[model samples]
Target: MEVLVSEVVGRGTVLAGRYRVLSPVVSDLAGASAWQATDQILDRPVRVRILEHGAVAPALDAARRAALVTDARLVRVLDVGTHEGYGYVVSEQLVGQSLARLVAQGPLTADQARAVVGEAASALEIARRRGVHHLALRPSVLHVSPDGRVLLGGLALDAALLGDSGGDARSTTRADAVGLVRLLYAALTGLWPADPRAPQTPGGETLPPAPIVNGSPVAPADLVPGVPNDLDTLCVVTLGPNEDGPHSPGELVRELEPWGEIRASVAETATLGEPMTAQFPPTGAAAPGGGIPVPADHDDQDTAPVTVQRQSVRTAFAQQDPPGANRPGTPPPATPTRATGLGPVPSDAETPPTGLPLITPPAYTQAAPPPPVVRRPVAQATAPPPPPEEETLEAFGFNDVIGAETAAPTTRRFDPTALILILVAVAVIIGVVLAFRALFASFDTGASSDTDPDPAPSASAPAVADPAPEPTAAETPVAPAGGPPVIASTTSIDPSDADGEHQEDVAKAYDGDPATFWYTQTYKRDDFAGFKDAVGYAITLTQKTTVSTVTLRTNSTGGNVEVRATDAANPTAGPVLASGAFGPETVLTLEPATETQSLVLWITQLPPAPEGGFRVEVTEIALS
Candidate 1:
């Protein structure tokens, strides 16, 4: 391994004459290099790890032991050999996406997340039982193959290459247990809740760092809404600063078995080299429209109209099985097995030839009943006569009188409806009067205020000139007070950035264009989860000037922002010029600030963004 040189290993460089390197996957990794290669004989892509300076004995031994494990969840090791004084181990290249890449896009569903993590835990448990541990497990090591199989790569070999040791097997196993939970945390929230001091494997940052407050990782549910309570509790308790997690991987397996079962069953019928989503082809009624269910307003274009046929009313609540659930592409039910002493009878089996009364359909005992029974009475068979003309008078309250059909048969009865009408009319008139009074009262009040009599100025004083009309909103100038503050340049300051925080677009903030502005990196929490206290822009004025106010027009509002007087690239806590929340129009008044050529716009807290997480956007800045 010491003799291996960097120049000898690279793209198109063959090792041991059996594996051909395609490209470098990870470079300068822990005194070693990993390459994506192909197996010459098998004509398949394989990963080859070349050690430039390390004891190959340990790595080779570890890889050999890992190769013996039969767990399907573990990536299979194909070959390990020395080529040109370089030690290399060949592994089957994963066809699907790495956990990091998938998570970088977005989070997985609860079931998918749990299922994948559970399988990873189970795989680690298998390796632990065989006295092997992968202390360097990270997001990149775990993968979901195209066929929907969960596979863990690197196994014990990753630890060996990195020279990672836990002093004993138990310690190493414990580290792996924690690693599995971390993977689970990432799957659910797309955040890593690891110790800030520890260095993560390359490509692990596909998920952002989890928000940490007071030296402990924040709860998962706190970052992503709708996280299951059980999952949230488990993550908080396990990945907390205390590190009180499962003692063994088996514990994780049992707890996650419920979620893993669904994914595991899905994997059984997965087709090779097909995307994982293809494994979940539409089922039941969804099969009719080519894996899409019919919408409420399908319009019969993509979906075929279904018509159900009924043979008899007895089928409605019959004890017999539903006739194979008449659906598109539905398979017919298998024939029921005959009763045999060797096995139990099928549930849908027909009655035996002996014709026992218990199971057989009963025979018709009485003849078919007569059918014709009309709505007309069973005895009458003819329509009833219409009501008499005198009854109609009762309808209008003219016929029936209270005492003694009256002293005179010719006397007419008074109707109660007439009294009700009179009362309603009176109420309507009173409501109209009250409404008019209120309306007149409001008019009088307005007139008194608008035309309040100024004390009559006798001819003793000259009449005062009429006051000039106030300007309307439309007539007000929309431009800045002193015109746009000339900004010479700007720079971004974000401690959380591993490479650069959109540095190329820093000028957009002061470009004098509202539509184009600079944006800060999205974070898991409003306070950046303690990753950093603040992030914003540092502006350099075209010339030093004493400005009393600094106004910012931003894409959003509600952020803790401050402006400090400084000319340094990275501003320090100095004399503050202005400070306030980010706004569509945030105006901050300077209090006795000194003249300075440079200024810093720092935002300590951010408001919620339409996208999940918190962010800041500054479109333009002005100084006066």
Candidate 2:
């Protein structure tokens, strides 16, 4: 009979007799459905995979069983059993988005992309050590949890059973690395790789490749403009060769250490069950037997009761069997023993029943009483041993251990008096050195002062000795402009070879074409001390052909400033349409002129100079 919603399986409708099924997480092609279940035993939430009746059921069961034996970083199978002809495997529920989602959003910042891949590398390293390989590390299979925990899904146990895949570990690791590299490339460049011969998915639809340039995977720098070279190198190295790269997850962790503090806060917040408002279809939310109402929000407090009940059930199972539990009346599986030596295998006469004596061969064999094998209780067996003494220093190499000991003296036996004396001596030495440095500095300062040039008089300074009689000239005033015209003024300057010549101090020089200087002063800065009084400066330009437009703008207060320009050029003399004060940064458009040369701009009026003399620098100009 098909199970219906709210139907209790085991103690409750949860896996391992702990979880309470709230709703379906996802339903797969097989009748198996993934559900969002609360752990009644642990008071936590988990995902339960309910298998449907199919040919793959037995195979999946075996895979799930095998999964329990390894140390792989693959998803942990919490419980597995057959209920009403339908098998289910309950595993940990990961709260995160798929790598595919992150890729689809857009290219990640260099740091973000590195972190994502670095995490995957760690998971892969763990799998490698445990002799398990995740054959599927595609964007779809890798999940970046909301808490930034990277979870790998879709193990290859079943695949191994189906084929003579001798290269399970190697192939999986290689493919995973390759796929991670591809994902990183996409994240950094917003482009896919260019592999023309690469086979497409079974349907003939091509998968996205790494970002490409000229038929080769493009460097991260080529894809994203202004990506740091170091970051680019990291991406390349990460994707280069797995064997030669980070040896293990620990090494990968070290490699990623240089990235500024990871934003683990996001992960922490996620772990605390912060509500996510953005609506996306729930993952792993399908019921196997019948209609079940999955909790819409995993973070909801109301779900705690269900989780508590699930935890109770889990606790009961734990007390019953525990992991590796061997119950009374159940014979432990026989362990295989191999005997190695010279002569033909001895018969029952030479070989002791248990085979312990055959390997050593006692001088005078007396039938030893059957050695009683003492088995620890399952609960005690599962408990970990006490941590070794000096645990902190163990992970570091011996050299590091010794170095740390020598460098950091133990304070327990230290003499305060002696330490104080030593500190005093050091302080005396430091003081002497500082005193000498101060003396020399003072001397140098005096010397510099003696050699310093006389300061120029301020513009408001009184004339010394009646500054030579003012020269008489015809008084010319255009409309008798007063107080700077109450000048709500804006200056628009176009970049050109002529402007380059007249403004050599401000224009950036280029080696390719001396006349074609790149616009370097696109950002506005308040540090332009000379242009304090100026209101604003707008640059206008037009490019005739496709060319990279370079601009450098600056303003006062070193506030927001942007350079804006069009890819095409204009023919008119007044291409500049408007100019405004930069409350924040302001982007002004410059249309290239049809005159073959990209227009150069100089805006001198916005920031008025003191004494009518202002200095605004526009260094470096280029069109390509």
Candidate 3:
């Protein structure tokens, strides 16, 4: 039902009796135009939005909703009417620039962006609670008044009314939250991260989508490097495909208010020179032997060797000195440059021209040196000497007085001491095993004594006695040994007896499938009703039978309930047999109790669901 107009209205046109167009401000490709006009009746300035022919109904509906929101961050909607062949809405003229113009100049600082978006979130929360959604929110529609108030425009109202939202109220709210976050990101980075499903802005200029990693969009801090981590996470959770957090504007506002109040700079500081690897303490102005200068403190000078840097080692070795040299000013005896672990030292010609005292090797020594080095034979002695093991036993201080034949055979045989130790170990293991067997025998005797004694046989061992009276409902069933217990089939008890809808779903509780569950309808209060505190189901067997135990599996946590057995037509009329609080799963072993036809599971209390509802879900049930 779209209306087409043959003529276009221009400047100086009169509309709805007295309003006169003074100037055309902006005309969008979407067939919506804004004009600066004068209210001839009131003699004051006003802003007007001209809508295409068939758009009048939705435009007026949105204008009415937008008019109810009174916030400094939102533009004020005044009136809605049509003149000639066109429809339009009027509002107070705002004196400021659009968010697009502000961003075009340059990106806003982090604090500025926070303040702006925080204000927008507060305004959006108001509209959200009233069920009004701005699905067409974009930078071009967000204006900042001259007095520093944020004004969000409503180019989205018409689009939402036209059924272009493609989603429900909750989904539209999600989109609006995402849109605000996108605007914040654009303000902070000067780049728009568009959503493909969102409506196009007035101009038709397109923006690239945010970068995706794995399956989700990358965080803002990763893209720009200086965005605060908290802000980045907020944006990702609100706008990314995997988002499952805070789906409303109020929740978003709570997360952003603290960020706006923070005053610290978020920009990363730059390093002017080469990247730092490691830093060494600065050297003093002077040193002995022209080596790296050492600190003047007496304690540090004495301990310098332990804390000495590698740079000092090279300079120290270059100036040769004897093992125990004197202080810097004192002369010492001539000494050769010993072969330090750092290889050969420089010759006198290679030394610096500066005349300085010779270096004294510090007394702090490392680990003991290896065995004296042996120079290889000059004629290429490739054949290695026999191993040290081949030497005679005397080389290792072993006895040598005995004859060679006896000594050689004795040394080759196993030691008598090791043989004795192995025999002792075997004896110990046998003793331990025998002790374990003895202990097991004692335990078996104790267990046999604790078991019930078998019924004594009649002294005469004659004819069988008369048959006992038939068991009645008062008698409990005796379970046979070495057999699995029988399970009973379950059915949904009076569903209408509880909160109204989905009562038939309770049958799933005994379906034996964890994937399917029975749930109670959500109630305003935790208790199901004023008269009764519980809701439940019944399990009935084909014939009268005994149930030794029952198990209930619930997906929820924290609630009290009772299980009972009854022969009456209704299970709730039975006497309680077991009672306890609920967990992931509950198992109750019934004590000696009367036989019954039906079992009842009644929930006497309730807990809140994760999202502000009160209900209970049971996944499966078992009886033994």
Instruction: Give the number of the best model, judged by lDDT.
Output: 1
Which candidate do you rate higher for TM-score, 1 or 2? 1
Q: Which stretches of candidate 3 lie over 4 Å from their true place?
A: 1-8, 161-167, 202-217, 259-624
Prediction 1 TM-score vs. true: 0.41
What is the model-wide C-alpha lDDT for candidate 1? 0.64
Tens digits of lDDT, candidate 1, 289-349: 4322221221232132212111111111232234555332235544444444333344543
What is candidate 3's lDDT per residue for 270-344, written digit by digit as tens?
Answer: 221111121112222334674322322222322211210111111222333445656333456455445456544
User: For every model shown, what is its TM-score relative to the native structure?
Assistant: 0.41, 0.37, 0.40
Residue 244 lDDT, candidate 1, scale 0-100: 76
Q: Of 1 and 3, which scores higher on lDDT?
A: 1
Provide the overall lDDT of each model, using Cα atoms, as 2-decimal numbers. Answer: 0.64, 0.43, 0.59
What RMSD does model 3 have?
A: 33.8
Looking at candidate 1, what is the lDDT of residue 416?
A: 98
Tens digit per residue, CA lDDT, model 2, 319-344: 33455556433356434333454323
Ranking by lDDT: 1, 3, 2
Candidate 2, residue 379: lDDT: 41
